[model samples]
Target: MEGRNLASINYNILDKSQQKLTIAGRLDMENISSLWPEIFKLIKKNKPKVLLLDASGVDYCDGAGIGLFLKLKEKQKENKGSLQIENLKPEFNQLMELFEPGQLSKPEQIPSFFKRVPEQIGKSLTISMREVYSQISFVGEVFVKFLYTLFHLGSLRWKDTFLIAEKSGANAVGITALLGFLIGVILAFQSAISMRKFGAEIYVADLVAIVLFRELGPLLTAFVLAARTGSAFAAEIGTMKINEEVDALTTMGLEPVRFLVIPRMLAAVVITPLLTMFNNLFGILGCILVMITMGFAPITLINEIQHATNLTDLFGGLAKTFVFGYLIAGIGCLCGLQTGKGASAVGDSATRAVVSSIIAIVVADGIFAVIYYFLGI
Candidate 1:
């Protein structure tokens, strides 16, 4: 057989029914494009019964070369022929070992829609169950630490608690106030527009006061805390965890739950109610501003607010703040503690912390609503 050199490949017709191809040089992205069509054309035109690929001359190869081998095997099989690869370089063999030729050669099986539905449901259910179990386990650990900290007050990290409180609560005052003010303005305007139709625009003050005192103030503050402080907690703890600082704490006989989590939890619990009060103040100020443009005096709006809301309404909302704070901080710390290893672990933990905190807050609010309804509060 006479061999013809075409670029890096030498093509030879071994017999009337057999063909041999020798591939050499670097089979990377730059070279593969030109070589692909040439080799494909040779296989199509010759339709060899037995195709031999001699790759010993190949000095370097990458993923593109692996793909070419797989495609050639498939093409040979389509022509009812056989492909044999011989004398491949050890390094090339090592790279090719990552892929299973048999798996790549076979067409991927796609499940029917009905089969896929059950598989999807199974995956979701398994993930949800694991999440629930993790939450329960973390909650138990937190509860134990909480009791221990309560009795052994000296063990509590007051310095860290105050520092966290300042960061999570004090520093967030501006954004929290702005959010409260906007919520109040929007609520007043929306309600005033509807109430004005009945010549009851003055009643917008009462509506704003009741809603802000009973719901929106605490809820909005908690949301801000979750988005801002909660995510930070997760990211910080996750970084420390992945860096093995948490393990070091254990080595020093310091409990991570007490040292890391308790401080944050305490800070959140203390600051949430305080922040809610600020939210209530700013929201009321916002309502007053809206009412002033609507031809109502500030005193008139204040009197109406006092008449519409009771201590119970104010206290009930504030109660929710404490729970919201606890949930936000606790869930954040839990997600951080559960962070997996990887470069992306810290980011993923932060995302999970925010999502989990928001969901827990909403669910807790719903439960509180149900409890209040039953108690006639």
Candidate 2:
């Protein structure tokens, strides 16, 4: 967030103890370095049983700052101590949501893996999966009616489709590019260390290209789209559900599933793979640029990149995007279709849709990973 806002963070300790330390101020981007020294100093001074980061006064915290909290948590845990972050604002709680793997929670909520296993396993996504298959199957019937409603090629729903496409693709231009670029840089940068040890640093280009094009591009693009357009689609449909428009369609002998769900599902099917392909291409650009900046020749980078990734991998990645697209749209629309008759229900459905789609995509990716790894595809 500091990078986004062109700002920084600086925190201080007001009171200290063998087991706790009261901290103050915002942990933004700029002043993080200054704050790090202070934290280490406290660690050196008392090696306290635990670090109680007093974020009671903290107004905001960015992603980078979350690392600081994690470090303190880890350090204390290593010594059989516990770290506690007190007085977190409600808004800050969302940032610590389980969107990513291994996010932290309140100190009291921490538990051993064995104790957590049953709870985690009990939270099955089977209900969500059933909803998706049923709703999306209903959508397929609607698509046929929709196609025949207008002309063979044109439909009244084209505007909605276009709007959705623009929202999902056009508006996402900057962020997608940024994500792709970052992915390329990260892939190559990490590979460079190992490649350099073997005196084959140029393979970093191949590493970046293959990884980005074959996996990261589609996964990241679909993930972001699920967060953006998937949520919006679910919210809009769910709102209509709560407002009785769905009921009105039923009364009028029209199916809400046909009119609403199918168009959204089709739009996602069309757009997600295109977005994923574009992501891989742009990420390759970033990879090439970064490699050249690191003193590799452009021609060498291109040659190596081409040789590294197979046509099968390229096509396989595109296929994964299609499956991911289906999962996101189906899950989102199903969630919307399930919305109860209340305004609050619409919001809850939207939030749940995004979260569920992401989880499904990630889980599906793991399944794909296992298939590819074992089958040697």
Candidate 3:
């Protein structure tokens, strides 16, 4: 080793392939400012494959000193060389550990849009396929657990089911009634305007009854459930997942689907149809008000409504509620169970639950319409 001593630091030419840098005295901003550029120049000139730093003689170090060490390591990295810090005191070693050289690496450049397009498509497709698979698997598990709960009624958590039902259904009564009433009033008023020209203004009752019973009432109720109840379920379950409570339950031999999901699903199934019926009642009340303003008696409007819609219409809409309720609850629970780590995970899960529930409800409603149409319901 050919060693040369500087004022407070030592430089050593160990070999052609390796170099040694010895740091000594107080390493602060003043010392580092001068030493930094000198070290960089030597490292650049030699481009040693391995650079060893001996910090045994380092009397003291501050933030600037720590920064200098980090910079030297970065320089070696650019030269495709390794830096080894040796003979550091425990405290200095601890300070060195606080900063990792990797953290200072230059960020990679973003690829061009054209270059990334195929990668983006492939990534999206892969994610979508995985999501579909997860949903299918969750559905199967829920179905199996539901069947088990059905056969063993005692296994269902009745208390939790009642609480969720109250929250999702009873607490939502005001908004549901208001929305349904407004919808009916709007539908009736619009229909009456068109029918008035033909001297058939009273047919507005028939139109309102048919549309609400066959389609809008249950669909709107499902939307409310998807937004309110489904989002809540997702947030609750996602929080539980994040806290590792779900894992704890699994460790304790409790099925998370059975314990957490079944109650919410049952609550949704029972409450959704009940809420739909309330929505229908309020909607009809709104229709009655509109018809009375048009000089039609309340009894007359009721008679027309009865004649316009039969049990098939009412029951068909209610049937869709059952399926909609199940899907909303199931999707919410599925999203919650799939929650990932990080600050935004719960919020993301809730959003996915609401969106997925709405999509599923619409798709299921369409399928139901087709089946009902073919069957002449």
Candidate 4:
């Protein structure tokens, strides 16, 4: 080890290889700025394949220090280096845990309510209620603005739709399939147990058919938008915000809402139903897989589901999903508009967008449920 001792940081260049470089040091907020220029310069000069930073002696690192370190580490890829951190202290360990946390991480870990998906959903929903209730004009404006958006939508060129469909579809397909199949499996398993107790195990197929087509289709499709498409919108619009394109649009006398928001919102309106149908198909496929393992006759399962559900179940779910598409797009675009001064704002806005979309979807689902039940279709 060759030691080049600076004030608080003692840089020990441990080894050098074609594929990697190793450095061990104590990095604190107080000393970080002094070493950055030299450290950044070394990075530029070495251009190694990987950079292993052994921060075993890092006693303290504030947000600024942590921020700088993350930036340097992020630049590693462009420099052909993969930054791997080791020997983090307890505080640093807690930070990592917060960023990438929980037992969903480990199979046997049952996760806490506040930290779990349910809690996140509840929290977002509560916020949504407050927002919607706080301003009656916002709801009126949203509806009016959406109606205005619809008229301009029909005049929109076909190429815009095609570009949007390709991007939205490709982004959302995988997560939608995985989550849809999982929900289907759990539904079939749970419903089968209940139906079996009632000597109606055959009804498991009916639940999958009706419930998936009508409810889970919209629900899952909206969640997919919350995760996949909403994040993308925030990131894209965020980059635009970062680049001042949104501001430029205003200077040019163009409405950022009409030019940017309309395309994505309309795309969601068109594509979500298509995705929901796909989700329903995959969900059914998953249930079929479960059926095979449960000693249910595949032929009988098909017959019962076919007889139990009709156009209403299939079409109703699809229709609800179309509404969800609008909600997802609307919330995402709104959050993007709220993005502020920096990359941190982009990240923060994207998170808010996803959380808002999920909450909006859940609330919309409940509203739709009430409407559908009273209609008694």
Q: Which candidate number would show the highest TM-score if scored against the true structure?
A: 1
**How much is the lDDT of residue 356 in candidate 3?**
92
Query: Which should have the higher lDDT, number 1 or number 4?
Result: 1
Worst 10 residues of 1 by lDDT: 1-10
Model 4: runs farther than 4 Å from truth?
1-157
Weakest lDDT window of 10 consecutive positions for candidate 3: 1-10
lDDT of 2 by residue, 158-214 (tens): 787677777777788788888888888777778888888999988888777778767
Candidate 1 collision pairs? none
Per-residue C-alpha lDDT of model 4 across residues 186-227, encoded as one tens digit per residue: 889989888888999888888888999888877878887778
Model 2 spans > 4 angstroms off: 1-156, 373-375
TM-score of each: 0.79, 0.60, 0.74, 0.61
User: Any runs in candidate 3 off by more than 4 Å, and if so which?
Assistant: 1-104, 109-116
- Badly placed stretches (over 4 Å) of model 1 are 1-15, 18-31, 49-130
In terms of lDDT, the poorest run of 10 residues in model 4 is: 1-10
Question: How does candidate 3 score on lDDT?
Answer: 0.90
Error of 4 at 204 (Å): 0.8
Can you write out model 3's per-residue Cα lDDT over 5-86, one digit (the tens) per residue? Answer: 2226777888988899888877878777788888888888878899899988987887888888888887788888999999
Q: Could you tell me the C-alpha RMSD of candidate 4 in Å?
A: 18.4
